[model samples]
Target: MNHAPASVWKNPVHFLAFGLGSGAVPKAPGTFGTLAAIPFFLLMQPLAWHWYALILVLSFVVGIYLCGKTSEDMGVHDHGGIVWDEFVGYWITMFFAPAGWLWICIGFVLFRFFDIIKPWPIGWVDKQVHGGLGIMLDDVLAGFMALACLQLLAYFF
Candidate 1:
């Protein structure tokens, strides 16, 4: 029922923050945004783990600015539509994952589960932090949580 502002389309920062407009969906924007990230993940999957990690660091840094500035412009804190966090979080979940559709699907489901469920410290950070850092941190934690689970699955199966 929530509609994204026009600036989400007009502004580049907002566009990126909105996960390339995936966040503009009327429902489950976070889910859509996370889905949007899969292609980028595929593109990056060929890189060495260290290089992918570097990209993670860079994207996290930029996401802070993108999420913060877009939130300021929209005058809303952590709007559901600002889903750059979801994109980065999904990427983090898939880090060092094996190359296969099965892994991709598993990572996606795990990341979404952690992100939506917000267990433990992820939930704690979601409540305690504010601004861009806060916005990104909860998802970062979710990503790590999902990554841990995915890595374990890979190890055991």
Candidate 2:
């Protein structure tokens, strides 16, 4: 518990605070956080592409605050539980994916793969950085890698 105050446990803040406690899961909390984003994305169906993009953009903006606040509350520089950044970053990864379950699966799997592996520049960012920006930035780079690979596959196929 790390002595988190009772106030942080209230309302949607708690769920958001705890990353719904998905971050507390014994294994692969970041993957779970990104997976949670899929349902929300599904609910936003039929909106224009720009609308989806806007939602992702707004989420990134909001994630900056929520992650920092949640981390502060948790008293860890970057609590593994604070994963809104991963959600937003994964959402960005799916931006170029065509709207379909197959693409969704691909995006989900590939994003998780890159995020977990943290190859090259992504790994660099994750290891060398600090704070909320570090938490989010590495995932953002992971998303870029996933997006690049997916887009490349799309182009060839």
Candidate 3:
């Protein structure tokens, strides 16, 4: 995807107020888009989980509106490029845990697993939900499921 623009017509940071513009990646956008949020999560690693969780909750609420609006502006439905949901969702799974590389990798694997598998309730939410909230909800739930599994693994090993 083309790099976000620099001037007024360019970067959504220039165009939109929040991170809405980052969701505009042109190809495998969601994945690349999600990559953008990694630094942020890494930075927040030292913060307490409750604080991080609050921020995430806020993001989830605001994300729906921004994601939906961005989708409309981009004229696409759940475009692969728009992956702020994945960023937040992945972080959700990593909550209350160490942010070391191995843990991060595990979180990523678990997140991808639940996100892709979309088993049971995750699948149900994905199908039933609509618009921006719908788009983000499935992922958040996936994150939760992933977190559960990861925690279980950590417990046994």
lDDT for each residue of candidate 3 in 1-157, tens digit (9 for 90 to 100): 4443333146452233123455455555555545566777898778977889888999898778766775666565555555768878888888876647888788787888888789989999888987788878998999899889889877886
> How high is each candidate's TM-score?
0.98, 0.83, 0.81
Measured over all alpha carbons after superposition, the RMSD of each candidate to the real structure, in angstroms, is 0.6, 2.9, 3.5
Candidate 2 global lDDT: 0.73
Candidate 3 lDDT at 64 equals 87
Give the range where candidate 3 is weakest over 10 consecutive residues by summed lDDT: 11-20
Candidate 1 error regions (>4 Å): none
Sorting all predicted structures by lDDT, with the top scorer first, yields 1, 2, 3
lDDT of each: 0.95, 0.73, 0.72
Order of quality (TM-score): 1, 2, 3
- In candidate 2, which residue pairs get closer than 3 Å at backbone N, Cα or C atoms, i.e. clash? none
For 106-147, candidate 1 gives per-residue lDDT tens digits of 999999999999999999999999899999999999999999
Which lDDT value does model 1 have at 150? 98
CA shift at 7, candidate 1, in angstroms? 0.2
Q: What's the lDDT for residue 72 in model 1?
A: 91
Which window of 10 residues has the lowest lDDT sum in candidate 1?
1-10
